[model samples]
Target: MGFLQQKNSADDSIVARIATLVLRLILVVAIPLIAFAVLYAGFIFLRDGNAPKWVITAVAIIWGVGGVAALFWIFNWIVELFSDTWRARLQPFVFVGPALAILAWYLAIPVGRTFYISLFDRDGPGTGQFIGLANYATVFTDRLMREAFRNNIFLWIIFAVPLTVGFGLLVAVLADRSRFERTAKALIFLPMAISFVGAGVIWNFIYVVRPPDTEQIGLLNAIIVNLGGTPRFWPAHTAIAPWNNLFLVIIVAWLQSGYAMVLFSAAIKGVPVEILEAARVDGASEIEVFFKIMIPTILGTIITVTTTVVIFTLKIFDVVWVMTGGQFGTGVIATQFYRQSFIARNAGLGAAIAIVLLIAVIPVMIYNLRQFREQEAF
Candidate 1:
């Protein structure tokens, strides 16, 4: 035992020395590289070719270099005070610093701003009067705002849940056995590659409108026109807006189905062959085995996927924004937040809407947590 301990200690000592050398070398290379980038940017400015942009670029590079240098210096100082053993332990942050800085700058700051906006009457331009709890109250009371909230809920339940689950299960099951399974999955999953804005633009043709006298270029309208039906404005019609919203939901489903299928397929493959064979031996139908055995066995996965889709639905914005611009009573919470803050120039109301969205995500998150805990227990 003493011999084994001695060997392990020797290995650890060797590893620690290697780590320290690597970290020190990285700091030496990175500091100079960042300095070179800033110097080159300065040279670009001196040449009078987009100098101001180059100056801004140089400033960013300088900030990055300075930050990296300061961190390395502090790390070395701490190591000297503590010991070289501790310096080796601090090496991982040499690679992780940029990611941490980005997260702090972009994600952390925006979240803080949103929270601050929720508390005040922000409107038009500058910081307006602080109105505590007033924005939250307005969210519940205002009729249009209430409708927008209801629409989001409706989308979450009716669209996000069924589409994410059903499409995932369907595609996964269908692709389980087939000569062209890979090709079919590749085709089905292709939509996932398209951006939200791009998807919205593509679907725009599907819901396009044209006058009866003119040629029908819209896909759906052209089909209707050929069927001897009158030309109709799809989004403009109040009776059709909610259904039109479903078209937008279809885009989200198309994008997310690939994600769900990938997860559920893995879960399905992990099912024990013995259990499946036992069910087959008992003369169980494939359908029965799937629903009664397979679905129940993978219930945890189903719940997780549903909750993830629910979060996405709650935070949906771009497709709706590009499609209807929150008109025809089809405005959801996310788009409404943007519209209120930027378009309507009512930052307080926008902040209120954003707060409402934050509250709305809470229940779904709790449900997700419960699912995770249940899975962990098992």
Candidate 2:
């Protein structure tokens, strides 16, 4: 009787363990389906519902914020069901999965699709014939494209970068010594709050031209006329050609200087005061101290600022679009892409132009990324 009882007890324990495992497997599949289905329904409602705008917006905000939290909570609960070793390993990936999926959908997929589209004509193979590399060839061979490359690579990069960086460094150095540093920095940084399009519009009044006898409405023309100079078309003067590109770029400098100033100021402040004192004690002039000590100390920040501006200049569109609409030799790569894509309706060519811009930016991006990794390693 004792032997029979022992065997029965061991069988019962095994049966219970098997039951728990089966239940867990079922829940792992069922819980996610239920949760995901509910989320999908909310998405459908948001997409197709005829609800009031405010109602939809409120729902969207709640759903976006709460839904993500709930999903995380649910996944976290699921993770708890696993053994300790597996749970620790899986949790990080579980949380990061959603973000990675989003980036793949939004960024990676589009780039791949754009590359595919670039290989064909205006339309895909459904209507437009396949023309491999023809669009890309046009990008290099076209006169307008060459001019745009010149403006963006040679002119804008050369001129706009130095003006913004130098002016910012100068301001940062000066402002550090000033009594009302905060107020002055705020005023200089204020222009960035305005939209790029708005900045373009504001500057338009400053550059507008009228007949010499007419009231000079433009700020520049008004000043020029008041000083006995003639009112000339500032932005649209194609006779002078690419010089007008520099004029447009000066506006970018004015807007971006504050950004550079803030970074430079932070970097400059971080330099050891002892070093500056030592240089001064050694009979070095203020200029020598700045060039020898201050510059080398903040050299990293300068490179960061330069690369950032280069990226911005490569993708520059809003100001140019608003100011001249790429007319009269002001077309950069971005403007040319816009003109080809939308206005000219040459989709393949436009995509090619965009890819070219992407290619131009990638080297700068790689350099910055490598710098970031090096910093992290350090």
Which one wins on lDDT? 2
* lDDT of model 2 at position 50: 90
Segments of candidate 2 deviating more than 4 angstroms: 1-56, 82-86, 372-378
lDDT by residue for model 2 (130-170), tens: 89989999999999999999999888999999999999999
Q: Pick the candidate with the highest TM-score.
A: 2
Could you tell me which 10 consecutive residues in candidate 2 have the lowest summed lDDT? 3-12
199, model 1: CA deviation in Å?
0.6
The Cα local distance difference test for each model comes to: 0.75, 0.85
Off by over 4 Å in 1: 1-48, 51-105, 108-113, 123-127, 363-378
The backbone clash count of each candidate, in order, is 1, 0
* Residue lDDT tens for model 1, 242-277: 675676777788889998998888888888989999
